[model samples]
Target: MHHDLVDGVPVIWTETPGPLEATLMFGCGLKDETFRTLGVTHLVEHLAMSTLPRLHFDHNASVSLSITDFTCTGRPEQVVDFLARVCAALTALPLERIEQEAGVLAAEGSGVADPVTAELLSIRYGTQGLGLASFNGPGADRIPLDAVRETVARHFHAGNAVLALTGPPPEGLRLPLPPGPRTARAPHPAPRTTRSSWHRADVPGPGLLLSCSLDDQAMLLAAHVLSQRLTDTARHQLGLSYDVDGTAVFVGPGRGERSIQLDVREGQEQRVAELLWHEAVRLATEEPTEAELADEREAAREFLTDPRTADLEVAERAADLLFGETHLDGETKLALQAEVTPAQVREAFAAAMETALLLVPCGVERLTLGRPDGSALPAGGCSERTALPVGSQYRPPLLARARSGAARKVRLVVNADGAWWQDEEGLIHGFPFTEVVGVEVQEGGRMLQGLGNCFVPVASELFAGLGRAIATIDAAVPEALCYPASALRATG
Candidate 1:
């Protein structure tokens, strides 16, 4: 079921029955100002999530060259409460606060300064307004907070917002929608059209980045075919790892670009570069084998058919909607991929090999070929420590002591006041209680928190028995318990 509320900021609510999960997605078309607002909005979102109560999870946000989104997931029943809190936060968030807004913008600028790829991107798209290094450049440090806040306040008005909901809908959840159909600003036009080409710049080393630009709509299908064919050929035929991947960027209406990058290891630069060029030329000249084309088609079909693969599709669809591009549906995307001939693939590749090429090599002291320095920053840095708090730990209790086949359940009270856990699945689930100690845990990251109560249930009969025994002992002597604490802690 889906419901739309029409009033101010456009909002839509969707409901489905399954596991209790909720996602709030906000979309705004990308612009220099939009990106600036997104940086501030992102920080504001963090502040809201950090301050909200009964929040099982924190919100996550992403900003792209085209759009920005902020999303959060939680229990279905908490949807209304969460939405209310979010709406309140958005409404009350101070855009006039220069210090806070400038801080976020400065941090955003610092993050992009040293990325060589980003520098290359800036150079490639430099002529386009899209090439601006950031929404706010490094000069953001000089922007007064009040001016930044005023800019944010103006940019965040109803005309530029869309609120979308997914998952089982809560009862009587209310949302504010736009007054009517909202029109978005048209995306910047592509530099040129229908010209197939490739160009390369020699870097000081043997690394290579190959990029090809096409119309966004057509490139979507082309990318699917190219990705699948390259992966299969590289891994099975050439004995290479599947880790070689490329990036696809939506440039504008009839234009997008895709690039395949590889870092040549020591002594293999020439061979690898020659092989890559030959492959590109061959792909442009010859048709893929029928069996190979069929396999790629199957991969494309599976990709469109699978829900897990739908995230990128959903994001693209939203982007297209915002940009006024073709309304590409799943069926249309799949049909296009299925019908794409090997000749078309060759033609696309042939054209792409001509436009622009970038090769970069790092770590080597010298090269026979005279190439410009492409290494932007120092090649190595310290690994980021996990966010888990220092000295905190966790240990799963032994469960083999009870009868192996017996069915039992035990509840655990997680006292993770300021700690977090990385489940086996690698998700960083958090618990904010300072001293919660009684809770039931279900499978996965699901748990219930009561007043001074948080429960995790264990179902392995033996483990359940052990937990039960521990619960009893702890009940009798509460301070004698010893166990590994949570691993997540805040760090500077």
Candidate 2:
């Protein structure tokens, strides 16, 4: 393998005897997008890719929270040529059919369930940079060409990107990209509340999702060992779940999360939940056996050294370069994996439990470790109160859907102060109009969505004067509530 700089961008390549592959990647992604211009990067990528002529090669463009990649696999010259064309397209984006691209993006967004990571990021941070992960990017009707053009000009450049190849470098592999500063990761969102928070995903195969702020390898090994034990207990021994596994993701430097989940039938949620909690507590208290640690280390080594995965490893190295991560070879990584003591792994698990959040099945209740429903928000003590404006309140002959999919009569109380809702469970939810991201109009009514995954739907007729109220509150909301804590702390 060799490293060099081409046209002011870092380029890495390995000489191997096979089909050549190349990837041009950028560090900017959804995290760089503003709340008002969410999905701009994705739209830009789509527009740029749409401009390219078809070539006889495998190619794809992907958008993630922190990176956007354009990769191709084929003959070396062909791949390099394709990438050159891609760079040219990105530089002079054909945003003319942006409306068509937006429609395509909307259809794409609708197919994938909102990632759990986005919600967790929002809860840990806020409706700012990284917290914007919890939101769906720009809607088909909202994103415009200028926004896409600006995002591209700001992010898609030489200094902010990397080029990686699995085979020998090709001749004339020119990346005539504009120079720009490398964008840094979004500042970590400060915690809104003191405790861990839980959210319902309405996903099948419900299980526990945890956001652990632990070091990388430790989190991975701990999750792996715990996953093994839980899988044996839940599936092999008790037959409670058919599958059990754990996944770890790096949310930020030296900070990440591990999610252990189980797929169980309808009747077994509570028992499985109890078993998972028991194992979590046990893992925190006791260390894994030497055999378990050895197995996990071997697994890590295999993943890093496997020849069949050389292309994937090249891609990972390229992405790491963009993100400023230390690049460790297969052997060094294996040694790092081997040096992790059982006690350290146990300590990581124990620490993870301190801020653990559990997602449970809808019917089954009472995970001893989980927070009660709706308790994730601040306890209400409204310092001020205001009644709805005349004719602002209406009792429609029907109900509307909250963000949680629960049915409730749409009752909205809004003033120059803020917005208020009293749910059927007798819990009061409040959002300063400033905190209100946007009001999504639906067939039944208006779903007032807010930060940290909260929503309140008011009947169409009942929210008749809502626009004026929104404007008034929007004007005053800035002064009243600055952060989420302020909004959570004040309401009527």
Candidate 3:
């Protein structure tokens, strides 16, 4: 293995006794984009590879929260040529294909109907940079050509890129990337809701998803330990879940996101969350046993010593460079893993649990769990809004409001303070008029979503006055909330 620098870009190459593989990584992804320019990076990625479909070798591109990876494998010559073409394509972006690429992304987004990860990001980050992850990048299609060009020029530079090779170095590997300073990781946006708020979604399969950000080595190790405990409880003793796993993503120096996920039967969603949290509380306070920590350390050593594939090793090396981490071989990594103390991991767990976000599959019923003390979410209330304009009012019939799987009929009242809906049991749910997130108009009625993760439906019977109601609500909220991408497409 060897590390070198081509121009200003970092290159990590290794020789393996197998097929040749190469990957080119960039330091910009969804995290680099703002709310208004959400999909600019993805658009650039698609456009860059839009010209490479004819290549026979295995080639693909991936865009993530903080990095973009482009990889190809085949004979050394084919791989090198493909990479050169990718670099050239990025240097001189084909602006003519912007609209075409935008259409592709739009179609993909529409087909998926906003994925869970995007929804989580949106709720966690609001409508800002990292928060834009939850959105479908609605403004992607309208981004101007000049803005796209500028994004490409700034991020697709030698200083902000890494190239990794496994097997022999590809011939004529000329990455004539343009000159630009390395881009810094974007700061996270201020969260919009309670740090430990609960988000619910109905997925094809039911699962309990817990996510939190870890900013140090202790936290990372704690995440691993916590995940291990939760997985054992959820999958082994509980007999409720089919699969459980923990994963980590390092976004920047001493900063990353980690998640503990569990797939379970439909009826056991809440129980799964409860059990997971029970184990989390225990780990946070009791500290991991030395044997357990040693087991984790040994597992790390095994994986590092026996990487499944050469391609994986190269990718990890490149990722380390992208996140400003020093490269470590198997022995060095194992040594570092051993240095993490049980108390440090326990303390990390306690801190992480304080800001944890719980996402469960709550069909129609809202699920709330008692978090550990001192880590409870702060109190919140209905947002403030001016009086509803006179004549901008309606009482719509109840229709099914889409949720996990079930919803109930409700009455919507638009008054001075904002809008409040009465559920089947006559429970009033108030959402400040000014805090409306987006309004989705459907065949039977219009679904109104709020800033605090509430959804209500106004029946089609009120369609006669729905237009007036929408206008009135739009008038009260910020201009951005007036017409969401989904609402605009629906109304148009």
TM-score of each: 0.57, 0.82, 0.77
What lDDT does each candidate get? 0.43, 0.66, 0.65
- CA lDDT of 187 in candidate 1? 59
Say which prediction, candidate 1 or candidate 2, comes out ahead on lDDT: 2
Span of ten consecutive residues with least summed lDDT in model 2: 480-489
By the lDDT metric, which is better: model 1 or model 3?
3
Which ranges in model 3 have alpha carbons more than 4 Å from their true place?
106-118, 139-147, 204-217, 307-310, 323-329, 364-368, 374-394, 397-492
Best-fitting candidate, scored by lDDT = 2
List, residue by residue over 1-492, the lDDT tens digit for candidate 2.
678888898988887557887889998777677655777888888888998787777999988767788988898788878888889988898867787787788767632113444454555555665667667633644664567777887789997899989876788888989998887556555545335544454444544445675345666788888888888888899888887866554567756656677787778877886787667767778898889999989888778777877777777788778878777667766777778898988887776766665555566644445332223322112112333333244332344343333335445666655567655544555576666655544444445556544655554544443555445544553321211211111146
Model 1 Cα lDDT, one tens digit per residue, 1-492: 233443354444434333333334443323343221224434444444444665566555554554555566666556666665655655565444544544554554443222333333443443123443222321333333443455335444445554555543457564442232344455554333122222233332222223454443233444445555545655566654334555655666556556555544456544444444445545556666667667666766787677664444544544454455676666876677667677776666655644434334333333232112222212111112244444234434444324322222222333423334443333333333423222232232222221111122223331333344334333432231222221221235
Model 1: lDDT to the true structure: 0.43
Error of 1 at 28 (Å): 4.2
Report the C-alpha displacement of residue 53, candidate 3, in angstroms.
5.4
Q: How does candidate 2 score on lDDT?
A: 0.66
C-alpha displacement of 302 in model 1, angstroms? 1.4
